[model samples]
Target: MPYVNIRITREGATSEQKARLIQGATQLLVEVLGKNPQTTVVVIDEVDTDNWGIGGESVTVRRKRGQ
Candidate 1:
């Protein structure tokens, strides 16, 4: 089985968008790694802005600073 994990900031991605992500990930694995779509697992984790960090600052703070 092939497993794919995707993380994004919790910014209210629509359900359709999430579904597309899962489908795209599965298709990519099937095309590149020859994995079976039926057995592939794609997981999306959404971290809160306050809990996610980049460039030594939390996403919440970064957005506040407009960086």
Candidate 2:
């Protein structure tokens, strides 16, 4: 079994987009690691911008400054 965790900001990502992400991750594991797609686990965690940080600043603040 292969477990993959993907984290992204809650920025209006659509269901179709999320589905594609899960599919793509599973496919990658199958192709590169010889994992079974049926057994692969993919999890996407959408976090609030304020809860995600980078370079000593929150993603919310960085976006405000256009960084």
What TM-score does each of the candidates earn?
0.95, 0.96
In model 2, the Cα lDDT at residue 45 comes to 99
Per-residue lDDT value at 21 in model 1: 100
- Encode model 2's per-residue lDDT on 1-67: one tens digit a residue: 9999999999999999999999999999999989999999999999999999989989999999987
The 10-residue segment of model 2 with minimum total lDDT is 30-39
What residue pairs clash in candidate 2, if any at all?
none
**Residue 61 shift from truth in candidate 2, angstroms:** 0.5
Total clashing pairs for each candidate: 0, 0
Residue-level lDDT of model 1, residues 1-67, one tens digit each, is: 8989999999999999999999999999999989989999999999999999988889999999887
| Model number with the top lDDT | 2
